[model samples]
Each structure stands twice: as C-alpha cells, then as structure tokens.
Target: MSIVTTAQAVPSRLFAIYAALFESETGEIKDRIEAWATPPSLSGRGADDDGESTTTLFNNTLQEARRIGLVEDIDDKLRLTADARGGGKKVRDSEVYFLDYMRRTLFDPARALETQQSGFMIALTWFLSSSPLRPMNFSEPPQVGMRAQIGDHAPKTELTSLNRYQNFLYWARYLGFATIVGGRDADDQNARRVIPDPVRAIEGALPAVFAEGNDLPIEQFLTRLSGIFPVFEKGSVREDYEAMLLIPVPDPGQRLSITTSIALQRLADRQRIALTSLADAPTRILDFGSREGRVSHVALRA
Candidate 1:
C-alpha cells in the first residue's frame, strides 16, 4: 500500500505492518500470520477462500495492512520492510511503528483501566493468565506439569516468551504490584533468582484457584498459596511429581484475615477491569510487503 510521507497520525495499517516486521528479516503475506499459524489454525475457520473471513476481524485487518505501503506487491507475492532507522530516535518501518502504535493506543488504555481497579498487581496476574500454556494443565488428562509438549499444542518456552513474562514482572515491580520478597536487588538479578515465587506458584494454582469466583480482598487473595501447589523444576515434570510428594505446598504466602465480603468486592472490581482489557484490545492482523523479492511478505498483529 502507498503511504504519504507526512507527519500526521500514523496509519494504523502501516503501524501494524511495521510492528510485525520490526525484528524479522523476512516478509509475510498477511498480518495475522501468527494467528493463522497458531493452534486451531484460523485458515479455513474463516468464510472466504484464502481464509478471508469478513467475520474474522483479523482477516479484515490483514486486508487493511495490504492497503498500506508497509506491504509491497510483486505478482502475487507481498514483501515487507523493517522500521525506518536513523532519526535521533530510530524510525521503525510502517508495520513496526503500527504495532507500537496499537500497543500504546489500545493495550495501554486497557492496562490503565486494570491498574485503576487493582493497582499493578492485577497486571502481573493478567500477564500470567495470558501465558501460552494452559496454566492448569496438571488438572487435565494425563495430569502433567508444564510439559514441553502437551499432546499437539506445544508450550512456548523460548527466550522470547520468557522475555515477555519477565518484562511483565519487571514492569510490575517497577510499578509496585510486586515487591522483592527475596533475592538480589539488581533488576535482572531478582528476575534470575527465586524471589519471584509468585509467578510459578500462581501458575500452578491459577487454573483452579480462580476457577470459581470467590469474594476476597485484593491484598489478601491467596492466588499463590504455596501449600496448595506443585512446583515444576526446570526440565522435569517427574521431578515436580516427586517434589509434590515431599511438600504439598512449596511456597505458601501469609494468609490475610479480611472478610470474604470485602475481598469479594475488590476481586470483582479487578476482574471487571481485566475482562474489559481482554475484550477491548484490538487483535488486528498486520501484513506487509518488502522491496526485496527475497524477503517479500511479512505478517504481524493478533
């Protein structure tokens, strides 16, 4: 798509495409390519051929990305470009810039609402809730704990995924939702150590702990009670099982004495904010085209 080199608001299509192509060296055909490639693929799930489902908002966003210059066209193949660089601040390509724009516009707003409801603690909880794997997979058939491969769907344990989780934790602590209960003071140091017990403990309990609505105060909710969970050591679900045999609750937190009514009210407020962000964040697809035929098309968003 042709983009006017102007300083007006960045086109959403260009922004989406740029975001998708920011770090990648290649191009893609559709913006929602990741979603299309994900489990329960969104290809044929859409109504039209080439998986273009008007009903599928992502498919529609991909079309919009095509309209922006972030995607280049050669024959049937589409190419994308990286963010524009060399300003005092780096100038990202349209797609990369678009992704950042989306984050700032939509995601940021949702987070703002969430913070208002429950400070920043809710952000960490929401981030964990959004982890790639089913946090409560242990409750499922075959009863496993954080397996590398669970049937067909694989858990994303890559550094990129880990970085995303760590970023959330970093931001949480920076904002005060998390306090360094243990470990060193350096930013990455605490992340590297065992101080962030809440992440693992909460992951272990989330599928069941928050399964049903319970009235609980924001500060005292036992989302990560240690005694009620099983810990998964790195690379060892078997070790997790053995460990569970040794200690039922490996990292339980102090219990609060607040009445259920007060806790329930706060929980309700936080949940409303969390659910609202989930509902509002636009999951648009971002496609881009590249000038180089070798790295022709790229997709991002969703």
Candidate 2:
C-alpha cells in the first residue's frame, strides 16, 4: 500500500485528474492526467512534487486512486468508478469523495499499524478537537507536551511514531482541515500551522462516527469516539487459584467528555443542530443540576 506522506497535494491533484477523466470521452488516462499535471492551477499547491516528473506523479496518483477504489481498470483502460463519477461534477464534490474514501480505506485497524495512517487520523482528530486555536510548528516532531497530552502510553521516542504525528498534521493541511502559513522571513524555519475551522474537520469525520439513520445518546457517542484508538492498561495481571488481580487503570472518561463536548459545541455553532436542555414538563426540569443533564444530547435536523 502506498502511504501518502506530508507536504504532497495528493488529494486535490488526484481529484483534478478524476474530474478531467469524467469530463472527456474515454481515452488513455495517463495521457490525460499528464496533460492535467502540466498546468500549475490544476496540479495542486504542493511544492514538494515540483522535481517529480509529470509521468511519475500521474502513475503514482493512478495507482493510489485504484487502491482507494476511485478508479478501476476496465478492458485495459482506466475508468472512474461510478461513485467517483457521481461526485465528479464539482471540485468540492471530488474533494469530499477523496476524504471519505481515504478515511474508510486508511482507518481500518487491520492495516493501520502497518500503514501508520490510522494513528495519523487519531492524532489529527485529537489536535483539532482539543486545541484548534494553537499554532503548530509543522517542521518540528511531536513535542513532549503533546505526547503527554495524548497520554504517556503514546510513543514518543520512535522515529516512525514521530513521523506519523508530523504526517498527520501535514495531511490535515492537504485535506483542508488545517492551513499552513509560510514564515515572513525566508531564513526562518518556523511556519504557522492553524486549524482555523475545526468544525469543518469534525464535519469530515462525522460520517466515520455515525452511520446513516443511527441515533445515539451523547454519552454513548462520546464513548464510541474515545474508543477509536484502544487505550491499554500499563501493567500486568496476575491470577491465582482463588482470585485474580490487575493493576489499576487511569480513568479516561473525563478527558473523553471534554473532547466530546468540544466537538458537540463546534457542531452546534455551525447550526447543524439546535442546543437545548431536554425538559420533562412545561414547569419542571427533570435532570437539570444533575450530572446526567450536564452532557447535551443532539437531535439531527431533517
């Protein structure tokens, strides 16, 4: 599987290719993609791929599109899948398709460890949900503070782990979940990376969290979100003939609650749903001032 690294505008460029193919009569896809790649406006904003030949980039994009099921080889010719064709009318539609496609394909646990893609997703989600206002340094590795916030169990020393976190932020920028602002001084290595609209990030991730026609209580939904990445106990367990004992585990419920609340508030701010306290009667509040009432439940609008 080809892992899309940081600083590459794979999604946009691929979408441009898909849209070009969808707009024209069927012919050699490579030739069409190569033509599309020649134009600066259609190619993408990434400077990293400038040195790469158009043919090389086209071949890489084609392979990735096939792997993600956006395109398929039919009778020795490359053709966009029906799903891709359905969303090919607009660039925004194509962008949405690419995100959903990558999410489903990359976030699977079976391939996550090998690909490190799932780790990136989880890290990006956490960053956006927890600290959207902060400016991040894209060139730097995952800081010790970030690792602590993510929990001590998170890998901090491994080169691959560090790369995964960095790549996660890079992917966020590529997908429009975040933005990268270049430093004013050409000599300065520090660039400001901001997630200006975390709500948009949540919107992209919502489909992964909820299924069509499925309604869940807010607590249950938050619990599900927290469990996206498994949290393991730090110590060992011992068993005897009569009893068994395991080391105590830290409670993550509070942290999950905070993260979930952030997501819910962002969604509400976007007018996705109205925030209201569930009331029992005209003059009575059933759960107000209670722990249960603190968490808001959402009802999807028609």
Candidate 3:
C-alpha cells in the first residue's frame, strides 16, 4: 500500500481550488475546465465573482507551479508531483530560523548592521558580486572617471551603494523588470516608472518556494543576486578606493539581465506599502517614509 503523504498545500486565493482538486476520492487534479471551477454563488449581496477568476488564477498558478516542478501534469491530470519537496530550497529552514532569531534577539548579525544604519556592507557585497572580482581592494580608490575615459561602457565609481543600485537598475532594465525613460532635465530629477513584471513574477513564484507561514527575509532576496556572482572570499584584491576581487559571472547573459531592477522596484514598493499600513495602526512611529521614498525615487530616476 502506498503511504499517503499529505501534500504540501498550495496557497494564494486559489487554495480553495487546490482543496477541491485534492478532495476527490482518488485525489486527481486535472480534468475538463468545469470540474475544478463551478461558479461561486453570486446570489448573496457583496459576494465576489470568484468562480471564473479563481480558475484563471489557479490556471496561472498551476502552470507556473508545473514549470518549476512543484507539481506536474500527467495525461492532463494535475497531481502533486513527488518532486515537490521542501519548496526547492531557496532559503533553507535553518536560514529562515536564523533570520527569525536575528529579528528577535539583540545579538543578531542583522541587528548589528541595522544599528549602524549604513548600507555600506550590503552595497559592497552587491558590488563585489557584480564585478569581475570576488573581493574589494582597500589599497586604491575606484576610478570614478574610468568608464567614460576608457570608453569601456561599464560604470566605475567610489560610491559603492549608489553604483550597486545603478548596476541593479541596469540588470532590471535588461530583464524587462522595469522600463527606463531617457529624457530628463539638467538636474536629472524626473519621474521613472517601475513596470510591474518583476513583482508579478515574484508574487507568483515565491509562495511555491517558501514554506507555509514562513516569511522569507528581504535580505534573502539579496542573496539571490550573489548566485549570479560570488563576492566574498579572502584572496580577492583590494585597493584603497576599490577592492578587486575575482568574481566570475556564471551566465554570460547576466550582463544583460534586467531582472534585478524590477526586483528592487518591487522591494521599494513593498516597503512603502508596509510603512503606509503601519501608519494606519494605533501607535506613534517616526515617519521614515518620506526620506526613503525620496531616495528610491531619485535612484529610479537615474
């Protein structure tokens, strides 16, 4: 007898559909359109039109889920694939637990950095990852004018945080995460729109990867950038103005990847939303929103 393992339940508003698909005696998942979606009762006042929309949402979710191997379609039947194990390990359980501990405890490494309130390390990590080297050289300062002077087309700057942000914007532009507008005034302050592609992709994908009830750290997303390039190791060169660590791009096309820009925008948006939501709560809190918004707005404008 096959031991029936309880499936790792899928989420989103489509959970009802998932439940229905799994509830049948044989727990089969796919069939003709009507099986999974019969319209929800529209009779009651304020009853949302969920029937058709839920199916559409489920269809999108299921297609992506299948693509990522969390589930599969066998003979047009959707079934929990045996391969759907532990959400595919983007951040391991230990890491998630550690993040939680850091958020709650005084000695958390995250708190150490948060207390400093400087994004220097984070920016450095990103810079090293995206560069040709794995470590920064403390011996010499980065050549700010090198890219233009050398006609290399790559930006070189000593402002690590800002440079890192620009690199991310470039990648995001390449990946269709956001669109860049060329026209701007002399001071360079103008509106830049962050297209919704990156947010849609993450909103669709993250739930499949993270465990139920687990909120992945925003820093965890930063780690994903490192996967494209390695930043930390001892032998990497360091000059006073810049550090030259040898980091290799695993995928050559990463130079063209704009996915990061989209993600960064989405991250900025979420932070804004969180702050706004917090403002509605019954507590006196410092308004960091204005400053953060201005900084992000300027970055995107660039």
Candidate 4:
C-alpha cells in the first residue's frame, strides 16, 4: 500500500533496480521490471516457486521508485529519467540522487501529513527533538511517549508496527539523517537505538545554503538548512508536530534541536565546516549536550 508496508524498501534494492533497467535504451516493457528481481533459474512457479516473492520485492521497490520520480511507466514501458542516468553510464555507488529526489518528492512538505512519508517525518522529528546523550529506545515506537504530540494529527492509520519502524530506520540511514548505535557489540542491530545525527544530510546541503558565498551568517544558514529539511526546528514539520502537542515543548530558548546541534558539532569536528563567532553580529546558540556555543557564521571547507 505504501513504503511503510514495503519492508524491503532499502537502497540496495533500489540500486539493483536502477542498474537492471537504466539501459532500456529504447523502451523496457513494464513487465520487465520484475525480471530484475527474478532471475531465470528461480523463475519457476506453481508450487515450490520462490520466484514470486522475488518479483514482489522488485515490484514494491518499483512503486517506490515511481513514487519518488526516479523512473516511470510511460506507454506501458519503463523509462529511466534523467535522474537515473546521472552518472552518464553507471549506477552511482552513492544514493545521492535517490535521496535528493526523495527529498523533492516523497519527503516534500505536501506529503508530510500523509502516511507514505508522514511516518518517517514523525519518527525523525521525534528523534531530532530528543537528547543525543539520552537516546530514546528505538525498541518502542517514538510516538509512545509523545502520544500527546501526534495525538490526533496522525495520518488515517499511524505507521506503528515494529516492522514499519524498522523500515523507518532503513530509510533514515539511507537518506543520511539518522543512525543506530549501541547494544552488545555496538553492531548488535536488535539492540540499537536510532540517533538523530543528520551530519551527512546536513553536510551535503552546505553548498546550497552558502550558494551566494562561501560563508553565511548563522541566521541565513539556518534558513537555507531548514528549507532543505522542513522537519528541523522552526521548520514546517516541527510546527505541525508542535501544533498537535497536548503540552508545548518546554522552551529550550534556542532554535536548534539538541540532536541537530550534535550533528553540526560532529560536522565541525570533521572539518567539513567552520562555526565562528563575530563581535556585534547576530548569533544563535548550538546546544549540544553540555557543550553549548554560539556562532555568527558558517563556512564550508569540505
């Protein structure tokens, strides 16, 4: 029905689909979409056929690709758009195009209240609002504690299953917004909790944020950044969530969420950016745990 129900909506499956059909050259019959996930040897059917399952996976993924505008069914043929041909001849190793397009389509503000993406936005916004030092247990649906937050603005059916939650985690990492950490070996997935560190996502948006110049004042940077991801503090998604809250968020007295601030600090540590303070200049505070600091300007270096 939606990506929330399409459990294997992972990037690798998307890449596999792109690699398989990007070369339709003339036209790829829509049915061929399933061939990508169903190899000849396993194509047998009727009884013990495992092929139907394979085809289902790609079909589900195809719907998502269609949803995100990466490819389309035109005149009964599958056509890869200019987006899929991004690398000129090869499938990109990075999901940059996929994610960028998703940001423009699936994650667009218009769909924020729909189940297709509202689930992700709700879960992510919750993660962003949380403290990085006290990571909330991903084992529980974030909305549990914040039931008051999404009390009723929730889409027709809230995406609340543990399985759908996993799908949320998958998309979050693929889109470069969140990460899971902790557990036995730190690699123990079942025990991992999602952390709101959109470092990579934020890092990629710097160029556009500083489009006119290499450096931008804090306010300008926040505007551009929030424009790219409206789920951030002071953004549309946050406003929507706040509007539904049974109790307003206790004023943090700062615009940046703790999780977002942690991400920016991580970016600074990576030398991908520079956060500077200037005398007599309007500034904003980045409250990352106990390391609170103010910045007047941001400069991109990497």
Best model per TM-score: 4
Model 1 bad stretches (over 4 Å): 1-17, 29-41, 46-55, 75-77, 81-96, 99-302
Over 1-302, each residue of candidate 1 has an lDDT whose tens digit, in order, gives 11111111123433444555444434455434535333354444554443544335343444534443244544444455332321213343433344333233222324333322111222222222222212211112221322322222222221123333343344333332233334445654442221222332233234444444432322222322322321111112223233323223232222111221222223334442121112333221111111111111111111
- lDDT, each prediction: 0.30, 0.48, 0.32, 0.69
lDDT of 3 by residue, 1-302 (tens): 00001111123322343334333323363644334343455222233343334445445555544443334566756654442332223234433322222122212224323433123233333343332212223222244423332233223322323333443344333322334444455887543433323443333333333433233332333233232222222111112113322333333321212333334445457652221213232221221223222111111110
Q: Whole-model lDDT for model 4 versus the true structure?
A: 0.69
- How many collisions per candidate? 40, 0, 29, 0
Candidate 1: C-alpha lDDT: 0.30
Ranking under TM-score, best-scoring first?
Answer: 4, 2, 3, 1
lDDT of 2 by residue, 160-211 (tens): 3444445455556665456667664676656655543344545554554565
What candidate 3 gets wrong by more than 4 Å, as runs, is 1-27, 32-52, 86-302
RMSD of each: 21.9, 8.4, 18.6, 3.9
The top-ranked prediction according to lDDT is: 4
Tens-place lDDT digits, model 4, residues 4-91:
6567666677766665665555558876766646676655442223234665666677887767556767788887677655544444
lDDT of 1 at 248: 38
